[model samples]
Target: MLETYRGTYFHPRTQFITIDKTGKVIESDNILFPLKKGDEISSINPFFEGLASYFDSKEDNDIKFTCVHLESKKKQQHTCDIEFKTFANGQPSLVIIHDFSDHYEYYQEVAQSRNESVINSQILELQNKYLKEKEDFKNTFIANFSHELRNPLTGVTAFCSVLQKTDMSLEQQDYVEVIKSSGDHLKNMIGDILEMSKIEVGKLTIDEELFDFHKLIEMLAFTYTVKAKQKNIEFEVDFDDKIPKYIEGDKTRIKQVFENLLENAFKFTTTGKVTFTIKENQRRARKVNLNISVKDTGIGIPSEKLDIIFNSFTQLDVTQKYSGTGLGLSIVKGLVELMDGKITVESEENVGSIFKMNINFKYPINQENTSLENKLDIEYKNSLSKEKYNILLAEDSELAQMAVLKILSQEGHFYLDIISNGEDVIESVIHNEYDLILMDIRMPGTHGDELTKMIRSLPVQNCKTIPILALTANLYDDDKKRYKKMGMNDIIEKPFDETTLLSKIYKHLK
Candidate 1:
């Protein structure tokens, strides 16, 4: 191996030298060092004195060190690597000197830049890690905060809906309506804040599809009309027959705009009627202009402060009598602008307010997806009365449970097995053949999301394909997406309307 001739021997500039126990040079390669056979090792280079000192301290192993060697006779310098080896059996030790001047100069020139790059890379990694953690914290905070606020709200609202149906006096039922209304308001406030967050974070997206414009108006009008009638205020809805009933637009967001307008109208007014009007301006090419207006007999907005009202977290009502988060109009504005629409307000203080929005939408050529309620046959529904399905509802709130049970029972086509906790939910599902499962997100012992994933991973035949529906109040927009990703078949918000729940169940089972 020492006599191998395939490669250059000992690199660019290397010298071999032997130093005896007394430190006198016995052998010399004079190429890099020029000490003769009898001269002292330190005579060839000044750095040899330091290398000799280190060699004297260690009895075994070779030690290498870098130093600037000065040849006193020639007055020249070289950066060199000096390796000192101590021999066994009392033989002479060796010192190998290699000049590293070229490589050393190159390393010095680039070291600072390389070190700066390493530091910048470390900083970038930490920043990314911190951002990811912050995002995770935001998600967790939204989920937890929504759960805490909405659970009791759901219970109160659900029971109110159920109690309003009982054989109670007019005043008593009216009181129940108040409770339900308040609960719905609180839920809406939560939704407003969350929706505003979505807007600020740029996650809110519009869903454009063909839906019944008439049905949307009818639903909004019906809700507020009941609210108005409850308060002894007359309510009316007028639809322009010239307007198309089905169009391509974000139906849900459009509904939200009207909902906020109507809610604000109703909240500020103590007497008189709130009229909702819908009409179309004109149609040019594939675009249709929609003019939606909500006129309320409420204490109107001051024209001076109207500009700031649409700003986020801005409210003019300082008396604080009305319950609100002040995010509704901001959300409405964001959604309207997202759909390329504009809103204008007309107001007279203490008299009335009218909010109008004009938006253009793609007039859907195919209006196949009309309202299902419009096409439902009463006779066919009566015929399917005997077609009942078995369902398991896992909810912890007693009020919500009774309300849902009453609603489902009213359908007269469901056999419900209600459980209060997730453990009972899992145990019941393992034993019974249920057509569907209604799982609440918040429950004792196990969360509904965790249980859903668990059941899907379990080695059970029925668990593989059984439809599990989430009936939860903790459903922020992100939660809905997350639930779907976690294998949830479908989701419904808490304080569900009886008809909507029935329709969803019927559709899924069918």
Candidate 2:
């Protein structure tokens, strides 16, 4: 118990000091260590009682330790490699302390770096998960919204066509034409949006079936040429003589793609010629490339904006003079690419644009690819006008019911019985025989796939064997195949044209 020595033979920078067995600093080169010659050091070295037994005779030690340091009677944390020695009586004699404060600070810095890396990784993982959820939500919202919008628009289209056929003055006819045109445009826009949604979700696919390529071209040409001529423009359709008559492809999608191109062609052109040409590009073992070109002579595209034309929702006309969603060409490119095909365009500022697409098709196993001879010499006539049919419709929407009735009434030869639900459809078929069943895909009790499977399983001969046609607004190609697999003989999309409905009916009936 002494603070007597102040500067008596003690160095100022000395850190190593010696404490005796009684935990008293008997010697200190630095008197600033909070202890003089006889001051107690038990507060800093709390394990001084056990230090004698732990280091009986050890001269060197590598075990590191973290302990407290005393400077001017103030405590601070530090670490060190400690060495100890003992006297002949096995009592602790000396301790050599090595300060390790800098190494401890370095270890703390490394731990902080690891913590930051883990935090960054967690944030990145959460962001990716949120993006995926947002993508899925967008797809679902688009699909469901498109479906809900189709039902009411279908009623409008059907009744508008019905009103068009009535005896009206020229002024009234003009108003009805406006309604029909606007409704048709709206319906097409909805279809394009749904197609884009399907493409985004990777749900759009190609479902190939055997079809007549010539007939398809004829139908598309007639549809677009009529539209072109309505605007006082000349339209021409030509095909190479070497093109095949029967081929295998996704016929519906092919028709959609060409219609999109032709619609854009007619839209951009004013009084020039709109021409469509189909020629052979390549012929391999079973694959063939059909090169389709749509050339127009109206106001054309600029050189710099060619790349942006195919972008979704990108319209070149800044004034918004045209009436389209600008999604047609986008959908066209997507569908063509899905078919393993390519499309290119050439244009001038004030001249016109020529859009060319090369799509591949394969020969069906049912066909003999040996000859290019024309075996299909069939003619398509409007025979449904004179035929009578008993058609049964199973639909849930009231507007859809009225629309369907209006469409059938316009057809003039069908005795149609409308059922509000799946049960009635089954019971009606069980009690009475029907020619065709137009089954809706979404209803209160049951829907298309389930209802069709039910009818197919029924013991009644009429129910089991009747041709059931699916009526749905589902835009995915896989849904059509799913409906077919569920025992549907054909599918007629909602918001259909009168001629299309009648043609489908007659085709399935006869």
Candidate 3:
């Protein structure tokens, strides 16, 4: 044991010495400093003076002290800690010295690493906060821009309808038709942009409801038949008769998917026929899988472009021959996947292309077998009454107001009053009786949501129970939810047609 201890470097660096009761060295290692047997302990270093005093007092307690040793030849300094102890008889017996340089360096490295980790954590937190703020600013800008654009567009299309009704020459009518077509095209482009934005931010969601499958197909047929005739091409629809009459799904998004596919077909196929086919692919208890395809003999896509066709802002026609935002196929793919469906495409350049999709829907439980036409007739008959309805329209845009007046004037069953701001709307509601209120969501002085709450709290008899519909151009899903939460009976998006407007008004009034 003694030989092993002497062979190690720590044994020599950490010195041990034996002293007598009078503080005279009796034995020494002689490794740190040379000392004779008769030398006093305090003669080598002043730090030992306190140890000598403790020995003279006959103290038996262990004591520790820090001291620095200077090497004269190398001019280097070493720091150490020393411990002193005595024998059982209360006489000084031994001393120990330990080097502490490496321990001090180790503690310094640990502290530096801790500080760096804290700084990195703080930097990451700030970056995340900055990204969140940027996203919020972008969403707000898009919403405001949509509102500004749709308000004027509503006026343009509505007035175009009114102009077409009057007598005019064939050439003048052709000019009017051109203007209307351009406006419709612009409206579709705006819709595509907004839909893409919603999908990118993960805010879009599917809203399922019961709808007539055959009726929806019929409407699509009527719309595309007109387009095919205009382009001098044949359009055909093949619907399976075995499909159920009523199904549960998002009717609007389903329609949008087909519309995009058909639009693309018609746009590309000018010389050949375009066909739409829908059939039942499979059936289980309460669930049905549908196989839908749009086949067009058009200028088809190249093989290399097929993989990227569904990517956002991707267009195969790099020459800018076609008029579109390139967001149609992307939106279609997003909607299909969100509904838990799959889509595929097959194409050959200059030959043809066929886009196929499969979607599943649930058979509506407890759904009546009555036809849609009959149901509508029943509702219409029940809505007939001897009393005339009074409707108040709260709109700030003069152009929008003019368009609404022209539309409602044709119905002849209601007396309409118009107000421009929130204060006027409140005063009019308190003074007169109104069966329904079409309140614009954004206006001067106050917003529509706040006005709806205030009206609900009023003491007037009709204020609390009257139907209030929000008219908005901000059609984001979150905005729609907010409008409903703020006491609105329903929502009516801007740039709506006469059929849609009248149907909502009748639905709420009834």
Q: Rate the local accuracy (lDDT) of all candidates.
A: 0.78, 0.77, 0.83
TM-score versus the correct structure, for each prediction: 0.60, 0.70, 0.74
Q: Could you give candidate 1's per-residue lDDT for residues 1-510 as a string of tens digits? A: 665753547454888888776688888878775677879887776566766564454367687887655463566666788788886556678888788778887887799789999999999999999997897677567656876776677667666766777799999987888887778777777777767767765677888887777778878877877888789898888788777778888888888888888888888889888888888899998788988888988988888987887888887889998868888888988999899999988889999989889999887654555443454434345545347888988888886788778888877788999998888777787788888888888889898988888878877787877888998866556777878877889887765766556666665664
- Considering only N, C-alpha and C atoms within 3 Å, which residue pairs clash in candidate 2? none
Q: Where is model 3 more than 4 Å wrong at Cα?
A: 1-132, 229-238, 270-275, 365-388, 410-414
List pairs with backbone clashes in candidate 3: none
lDDT of 3 by residue, 163-242 (tens): 78879999999998998888888888888878887877778999987789888999999999998988999999999988
Listed per candidate, the RMSD to the true structure in angstroms reads: 10.1, 8.4, 7.3
Q: Which ten residues in a row have the lowest lDDT in candidate 1?
A: 371-380
Better of 1 and 2 by TM-score: 2
Against the true structure, candidate 2 reaches a TM-score of: 0.70
Task: Kindly list the per-residue Cα lDDT of model 2 for residues 1-510, writing each as its tens digit.
Answer: 134465565434325666665656666565234557776655455644456444334444333335334323456555554555446654445555656556767877998999999999999999999998998998789888988998998888877888888999999999989998999989989989889878777799888877888888888878877887689999999888677778888888999888888889888899779999999988888888788899999789999999988888889998889878888898998889999999999999879999998888997544555344333212223533346678888898998888788888875778889888776677787787787888889877777788889889989877767889888888576788789888999888877867667667767664
Ordered list by TM-score, greatest first: 3, 2, 1
Error of 1 at 32 (Å): 42
How far residue 323's Cα lies from its native spot in candidate 2, in Å, is 1.3
Q: Model 2 scores what on Cα lDDT?
A: 0.77
TM-score computed on alpha carbons, candidate 3: 0.74
